[model samples]
Target chain A: MTLQILLNLVIGMVWMLLHDEWNMLTFTIGYLIGMIFIFALRRFFPGRFYGIKIWSIIKLLLLFNIELVKSSLVVIGQITRPKLNIQPGIFKLETKLKSDWEIIMLTNMLALTPGSAVLEIAPKEGIMYIHAMDVAEFKQSIVRTKDLFEEAIIEVMR
Target chain B: MNVSAIIEIIVAVMVLAGTVLSLLSSLGFIRLPDIYTRSHAATKSVTLGILFILLGTFIYFWFMHGLISIRLLLGILFVFLTAPVAGHLVIRSAYRSGVKLSDTSVKDELRDDLKKMKQLEQYHSKEG
Candidate 1:
């Protein structure tokens, strides 16, 4: 991914030099041209083009922000309710993520979203212990969120 | 009325919303049942609140002063990266040190897994 970005930047610079226009617009056009060129010859590269990974990352961030807002609202509601009716608990999450980076990403995302916090990760067993504000309410959604994040992480990583 | 005025209005709204969200998060911290849930409030809403506030500042500087502040952008990024991790670590340590969940808590699923893990560790040590 870094290589692709470096090469694209070099291509953009070269295009600007050729056009004798060192402006933002010229450089952006050059970058787009280089992106397309890179996409076409992506098979020669060791991995996926950086643009796809970048897009996946943006999608992941967008998903996280949306989830954050939704969950924050729910938490606010929970806090302001006349009577607290929460059933908090610790639950085991069996994660499909194998690598340290992906596991860490999932852990962090889980911690912030939808009334959950990570307690511990048993990497050997591929299990994470999550503490949920309302275990019954969040169980199904937690699995769905995990799958959503796992897919997004795989897109960026694999 | 003008573009700069409109931008200032937006910045004001953003900052206000951010402040409200942060206030709600602190409310959550105070009212939540346990350390785990409290950390949730501390991490998620607070991060979003700070993000909104920083973004508002960034936009304000860009439009009002014609200056794009890298510090504001980096501050937003840093909060996004660190808040959840900090919350997670705090909760993890609290749990590891055997903090009890609230009475309202429905279940403790990790206890069985932890017991099995401890037994495995003991078995390994005995063999060694």
Candidate 2:
């Protein structure tokens, strides 16, 4: 839904019309070709960015899906098991990520991964307080999850 | 034996599997203990289930139909973009309104830390 992709879609539709074939197949082909044209003409335009990092978005999405599955499994396992052995706690995490948007994204990532919820964020102070269902090995989870998501997010946003 | 048939099989499998995941998410939603844990069920599993379902649908149109359905792709992005934010908002609002953590929860490090900070603030106010 980025602006550039919207432009690309228009260009693709135009391309289909010009070719005298308005079928889905022709439209798709035109879209890919339009994308290539935009990529090739990037030097001339000097626009801030075309917002066409399709590959990067795909990779980021895959990372998200994998994390979602892994964490969902962990939480479900804890929930449905014979014996409940969870050490639930709320902990303050110091995040190097600055900006309200970045903090919001990070908090959402925390909520979506594992059984952790972002209770509050002190954005100016660069800290987020998170509540987790399983805090038995809290440090390890924090390290592994923060590193994975933070790295991926920085890359994707960049 | 053709490539398209194989692709169709893969797509079918993705769709079926995604449905199963969605089902599990709902099951978890009802079965989880409390609001805090229930939020976990609602957020993680449901979002992922939606992702897989969208992925399957996207591929079905893209590969099988030989037509890139950018709209479906956009729908996937929309879900991905919003799901977590909504989840975070729900939990944040709950905490802000003092929706209690489950009774079985062992520790509340934040509450203790906040109380200590408040005590320190009072002492500093007295000194000043």
Candidate 3:
């Protein structure tokens, strides 16, 4: 990260000299250029392509937005309807993820999803207490969450 | 109309859509039955709404003015990082304090686990 920032700064400075304007937009463009350079140089560095990880992370973020939009609309539907039949419950989610950081990221992602929040996480047990808005569809949600977010995060972490 | 005029119109529409989503979030906050679900409204919609607004602003500044606002970029990143964490903290505290689940709630697995722990503690105390 530090290396990337240092390289970006040098490129930004060079861009300012070329453009005759030392403003933010030029620097941002330079940063993008520097990032592309670094990404292209990934083969030379060897082992763990941070650029690929960032790409996967961006994909994860896009997936998050899709889930967010769908869930928000679902919750809005629930809110608007007269017959509210929400079956809110807290259930234990045991994840196969080993590291603390991975677990934290998973929990946070779950919190941001449509119908769930992490109430507590017991690392010793490798379980998180997730509160859900609707329990019936939770099985599906859990499967989808694991398939979408967890799988991508594992790729990003690796 | 010119190309710049069309861009301005697009920017205005994005900003308006963002504002409307935020208003819906507030309505959900007020209209939702319980704290747990309300936190969803507070976190998800608000985050997306602000993101839309920021994207519009980013386009306007970057394309029209030929300058980027570092602060705006930072604002988008800051919100993405902190909003969900803040909402999580709020609900976590509420649950820890023994806030009852909504009337519609079916079961609480944690409370059962707490009860089992308490029972184990009583048994150990008796032996000691």
**DockQ for all models:** 0.78, 0.49, 0.59
Q: Local distance difference test, per candidate?
A: 0.88, 0.74, 0.80
Share of real interface contacts recovered by each model?
A: 0.78, 0.59, 0.62
- Tens digits of per-residue lDDT, candidate 2, B52-74, equal 77788888788777887788778
Give the CA lDDT, 0 to 100, for residue B113 in model 2.
Answer: 58
Model 2 lDDT per residue over A29-79, tens place: 988887887777667664434544556667766776777788878776776
B12, model 1: CA deviation in Å?
A: 1.1
Write down the TM-score for model 1.
0.93
Q: Give the least accurate 10-residue stretch of model 2 chain A, judged by summed lDDT.
A: A45-54
For model 1, residues B6-94, the per-residue Cα lDDT tens digits are: 99999999999999999988988889888878888898888889988999999999999999899999998888889888988898788
Task: Estimate the lDDT of model 2.
Answer: 0.74
Best by lDDT: 1
- What is the per-residue lDDT of model 1 for residues A96-153, given as tens digits with 9 covering 90 to 100? 8999999999988887788888888999889888888899998889888989999999
Model 1 residue runs over 4 Å out of place are A1-3, A23-25, A43-46, B125-128
What TM-score, to 2 decimals, does candidate 3 have?
A: 0.80
Q: Which ten residues in a row have the lowest lDDT in candidate 1 chain B?
A: B88-97
Go through the candidates in order and give the clash count of each.
Answer: 0, 0, 0
